[model samples]
Target: MGVRSLPAEAYYGIQTLRALENFPISGLRPLAAYVDACVLIKKAAAMVNGDLGCIPADLSQAIVQAADEILNGALRDQFVVDVYQAGAGTSHHMNVNEVLANRALELLGDQKGNYQRLNPNDHVNYGQSTNDVIPTAIRIGGLLALERTLFPALADAIATLDRNAEGFQAVVRSGRTHLQDAVPVRLGDTFRAWAQILSEHLIRIETASGDLTLLGLGGSAAGTGLNTHPHYRQRVVARLAEFIDQPLRPAPHLMAAMQSMAPFVAVSGALRNLAQDCVKISHDLRLLDSGPKTGLKEIQLPPVQPGSSIMPGKYNPVMAEMTSMVCFQVMGYDSAIALAAQAGQLELNVMMPLIAYNLIHSIELLGNTLAALNHRCLQGIQADRERCLAYAEGSLALVTALNPHIGYLNAAAIAKESLETGKSLRQLVLERGLMSAEDLAQVLDLDTMSQLPGDT
Candidate 1:
């Protein structure tokens, strides 16, 4: 078919089609959450125009009503474009603008795609630029993804680990450092540490979200608000706050909004921190589930897939491995975002498109991966209690706890003798007269070791 151009269709040009066809790696179309965010921005802009008397109240009301419909799932089919394309999201902004304008026109008894009756550019995108609107939408979409998906999934993972902690609190296990036996710890303590790392990252994510709340709505082209009316900035941002029910604040300096992408860089850093934590946790989980016979076999991860095509009774820690791979990908995306942020130039950062694409992609991936890690790995995780206790019993490193009572020299001697003789540390302690049976029992109690003296 030959190209068909509607009067107000900004993305119907050949360039857009070619770009869309070229970059098909992700194949992921724009998300509904993102489209809803775009609608929210348009609604806010319309409301601002009405407040400034730049547009008629009825037109503003109509535009907002149309946007609300879209927000509530009215024109979802229209946003069938990938997020990673050329033109700095101009195509996306115009697509949304045209959809909202056409919907508003239809509400007013006008035909769809009739830009002359209700021009998308002139009216719908009255005081905005793809430059400003796209980045703002990226932030809004990111925040929404965090709230609706990432945070909750992470919380579930934390809760799962917390429950595991409780379940394995009494099972003593040998902790390792540099892949070597280091000390005695409860399996519960190990899981609790995992939960703590996730909890800390959750705080970091919330802090990163703070940077996202500073939107560039009023900052039109070049972030000067030059083409926009003087009062437009505050009005639009305020209306956006109402529409999204988020505490969005205007960028204190419009020039900074246009020139600097520090907020995105900060968000990327937070995501990198999260990815690092995931990598660490996944790596540990894989090691803990290393082998059923030959390896440490400290814990048994729920087997979702077979380990081999030919080997029988082989279960793989596929979830852990996949989670680690996703984390590595996220770290790479974070690097891309950082490099893009560094590449920002003078009055306008032309790299906003890449930044938006990577940040949104990272957020979504992190969210989905975390959900899978929680459901497939953490929630279904089972500790090999007998195996863990056996390892603990066999480890001479448990002598570290005895050091306080028996003195470091004697503790080392006991540990060395136990290792040389291949005897249990508890039996060695008693045989060496390091402590009586009652004292050894008190010291060897995992609960006693985990708590302070008065607490126990």
Candidate 2:
């Protein structure tokens, strides 16, 4: 049989076969992830049918069993194809359906590809179109990736930084604005700010997830619900909710669902925000980890690899570097998603091929990057306690904390004298008799200084 005639196979056409042979990057086959998604979709589809009283009980049981086998990694051997093709993932979708159908037939003691007894398209796919199924699967996969991987890793990072804040609460460091020293802040406060940023990102992620939850599954074909049963929409969504263990609602308007790619763009935007935040944090970490000899050396990053081939004993912040790269890739993916979103035409978006690719890549990359950052960077972070304290003690900015207790002119004079004479502010204050020893100590105390009248 010609490759085109064999709908059961992935690389049936010479063009497809050639593309598969040429694109050897990511040695991992394309169908593995798709098949996993397909398995979930199939389970969801069957559950939807079962709920609507359309599927035979025995058939539903068989489909569920086959889905379990695919989920447990039994059918990956059959999924040998590249995911980066330009055909809108039709072949990819069919490949998954064929694999599941054949597997389901096997469970029923029947031959593979026997569409007469059990068709991959008619039975396995049911009312789903690649348009609906592919995007739905992308959302499902993205949600799972975030819930299982990204959120936990980010939560770990927040918790790690929170603990670091508590541990370094007393260790004061110079706070910088526009890359210049501005004020003295506790090292804990700096880490707390980072933690809060990540916490806000997590909340944004949760909000983006709501967009993913609004799926277009029942919008068969061009989102007009053509060829789909009247009741199939709600049934499939309810089933998907149960199967995926996440609440998924049908798009209220099928035409809107079919014609727009805004949800994907929204997801991309959320990821971009997260990636930008990561880049900011990584940049800060890189600066803070600058040098052991001549640079800020504010905090030491956990060294994962050698900095250079010739430089001996030089450790680079590989975790931070890798995270920054991931952020860059996420930004690129966001651009791809934006381009793909623009590529949507009249009735349906034909750019799902790239949209799915970029969406999945962004989710996986963000998840993995967060996991690595939490484990390699945030977990081992430590403050240079004495160095931080020394910097804070030497800062002229601390004079603001004393200005209310001693008038501004006196405070400025004391700060000027201390800076010129290289004397501690406390020493200068007491020596000049600007304040008594007890008064100077009280004014300099961080709590008392922070609460002094007119400080806020």
Candidate 3:
């Protein structure tokens, strides 16, 4: 490559400069969590290399200090490589290496670009290859996302749903199947079921994330562990585990770990599963809160902003709609991750940057979407008690209660007559003498009909 000059203040070096000029792709930079994951790896490596006598103590100290500064929110803009850079994330890897190496040089009273005293490849990225480091960073980034964002958001959502369920427990409503009234149901139980759905998704996601704990760090170039110290694998993993406070271990087969993107695929698939549920829940909210005059109106969602530009006083289920959009994005990201996972050749997966971005971004996106939905929508949801009761009473499905008492054929005939004559099912049943008024009252009681089996 020809000589290219970067700004005097730039911490990134020539390789990064080449990358910047070459890959002017998506303006998106590496995510904060992704940056943190890479920096953590550098810090752990520096500490371990220092102890193992692989690098000089002073240089290792400088590198560690530089990494700490990045972790503590410094020099973030220096990671200027476009996300869609060279395959296997080599460009971004070098970007991180250059920034840390140059910063380390500065910390040692040397000028930036002084690779003689502390080089990026020869020192900062010592004993590590992009193949192993990128994959491991994806894992750590996923873990960081789960711990810092998704898990907490999920817990909050589940709690909010539980609270809503308890509050709306007594509101009986019409239950629709196939978009037609089928039976009576308590509105609260619907929220409870959603809570349970999210809880189960949480379990599945946690299970899928378990594979991320196994790493391919010491595998180096091609999982051959070439040029790596004998103790580097275990020691580095141990150091990383301590650094992130997670129990990480070396993969039994480093080649498989580096070569297969299964862990990322699994995590993304789990996110896809969760996203599907989120879309379902969001659509349900939208339907329940459809309109004030023309739609179901079984519930009211608090309006965050005016929904329509031309129509005045029009507020929509914006949070739920936003949730569906984010979930759909997660599904799309999962698809990309699956394709990337399979596209890898023998030794390395060249599609790692795509996987890394999509997987981690999906987690953070879904997490933020859920948090917004919970805070702005679910928490403020107000059930329409009068509407719920009216729907429960008016639904033709109420004839279902007459089956055991009067018989299925008789109930069907009553329902037909009620629809034809524009009369109520109760009126038809009473006129036809299907059952006594007292018995009919007990059978058609919305509270009793919608109550769960164990409810008092």
Model 1 Cα shift for residue 144 (angstroms): 1.2
Q: What are the per-residue Cα lDDT tens digits for candidate 2 across 1-456?
A: 234344454312333344455556565455245456667888878766766666666666777788898799776776655666544566567667777777877788887656687767777778888777877777777777777667788888889889988887767777778886556776777788899999999898889778888888888777877667788888778877876688889888877876687888987898899999999999999898788878788899888788899999999999998999999999998998898788877877777767777777787788889888888888888777777766666678788777777889998898788879888888877777877888777767654432324434
Model 3: clashing residue pairs? none
Indicate the worst ten consecutive residues by lDDT in candidate 1: 6-15
Q: How do these models rank on TM-score, best leading?
A: 3, 1, 2
lDDT of 3 by residue, 1-456 (tens): 567878999999898889888999889999999999999999999888889999999999999999999999999999999989899999999999999999999999999998899999988888999999999999999999999899999999999999999999999999999989879999999999999999999999999999999999999999999888899899999999998899899999999999999989899999999999999999999999987999999999999999899999999888998999999999999999999899999999999999999999999998898888899989999999999989899999999888898999999988888889899988888888877888889999988989888988
Best by TM-score: 3
Q: How many pairs of residues collide in model 2?
A: 0
Once fitted onto the true fold, the runs of candidate 1 whose alpha carbons sit more than 4 angstroms away are: 1-28, 80-82, 404-410, 426-447, 450-455
* lDDT on C-alpha atoms for all candidate structures: 0.80, 0.76, 0.93
Better model by TM-score: candidate 2 vs candidate 3: 3
Estimate TM-scores for all models. 0.89, 0.86, 0.99
Query: What RMSD does each model have against the real structure?
Result: 3.2, 3.8, 1.0
Per residue, candidate 1 scores C-alpha lDDT tens digits across 114-230 of: 667677888888878887887788788888778778888889889999999889888888878878887777788888889999999999889978988888777888787757889
